[model samples]
Target: MLNDTVSPDFFRKDAAFDELYPEHIRELSQMHWTPIDIARKASDFLAVPNARVLDIGSGVGKFCITAGFYHPETAFYGIEQRGELFSFAEIAKEEVNLSNVAFIHGNLTELRFDDYDHFYFYNPFYENIEPDSRIDYTIRTSFGLYDHYSRLIYQMLDEKPSDTRLVTFHGPDKQVPPSYRLVNNSSYSRVLKMWIKE
Candidate 1:
């Protein structure tokens, strides 16, 4: 049962939370998944009650799961293009029993930005440009793909209304549109940054 499998402490740390995944997926936690603390902090900034937050290329649903658990009043949704990663995220979400969180098996291009009030990104397209950092060979990667996705996301963020909130981890400022202003950033969390559209 989920009740038997889950505990308060499970969400407290990265190691304990990552235990929800299988060994192979767990191994990718450090490099790919969002850390628990960073997830919580990002959620705090993005999760306005009754609002929907979208995690772009949410690998294995780490950010969605952790953020949803921390901020139940807000809805957390993740979009992942990889079938294998999406499947694992679904399994983990079921195990966690978090009703406010959801996972979608599709590319970020399939998303409608109007559907969400806030956004979170962990430099999902970086893998395409950084060959050594790629998660797997399941998807094609290239500098072209990275640039395309980055421009697409920049346009998406630009189109959002004023007051839209966004959080990014390990992403460059260039990916963020100039209309969005940097509001808060955590040094301890490294590249964790919060932005607001003006």
Candidate 2:
């Protein structure tokens, strides 16, 4: 069971929240993880009572954990391909004691989209094309893999039910299906966009 009243202390700033993880994981914050404010805004858009929001390519579980903290009624699930990141995500979630958050150690292609009602994406595939931006060498990175993953996500989103919500932070619009209408975008930056399936 989740606490009825949640504190906003951990979410006060990016630096504060990064303290939940180790030093190395904290160093990857700027490039790899979602900021606290963006996570809150994205969660507000995606959170529906009892809905399950999937964070595609969840790195270190930053987005999922933050979203889960703010929206106790909704569940936030993260699917990470890296085992180290997945393990760290689990540890952070335990420290936060958030029951609404869960992390899966697997690739996005292995998941069944039907299990989730909404999505949060943060340009998880960019590392494939940009060699310097890669998080690590644990996974294979190639332009071919990038196209394959992007196309797979596009197709998956196209098949979701009507009214399904999606939030993309720093993600390209091309990855989203044409059927998903642009609902709105964050005032903070054009990179954060919200969409809904028609």
- Model 2 TM-score on a 0 to 1 scale: 0.96
Q: Which ten residues in a row have the lowest lDDT in candidate 1?
A: 1-10
lDDT of each: 0.88, 0.91
Top candidate on lDDT is: 2
* Per-prediction TM-score to the true structure, in the order listed: 0.94, 0.96
How close to the true structure is residue 179 of candidate 2, measured as C-alpha lDDT? 95
For model 2 the local lDDT of residue 135 reads: 91
- Judged by whole-model lDDT over C-alpha atoms, candidate 1 comes out at 0.88
For each candidate in turn, give its C-alpha RMSD to the true structure in angstroms: 2.8, 1.7
Candidate 1 displacement at residue 41 in angstroms: 0.6
lDDT of 1 at 122: 92
lDDT string, candidate 2, 126-170, tens digits: 999999999988889999999999999999899999999999888
lDDT of 1 by residue, 18-94 (tens): 88889999999999999898888898899898999999998899999888887878899999999999998999899
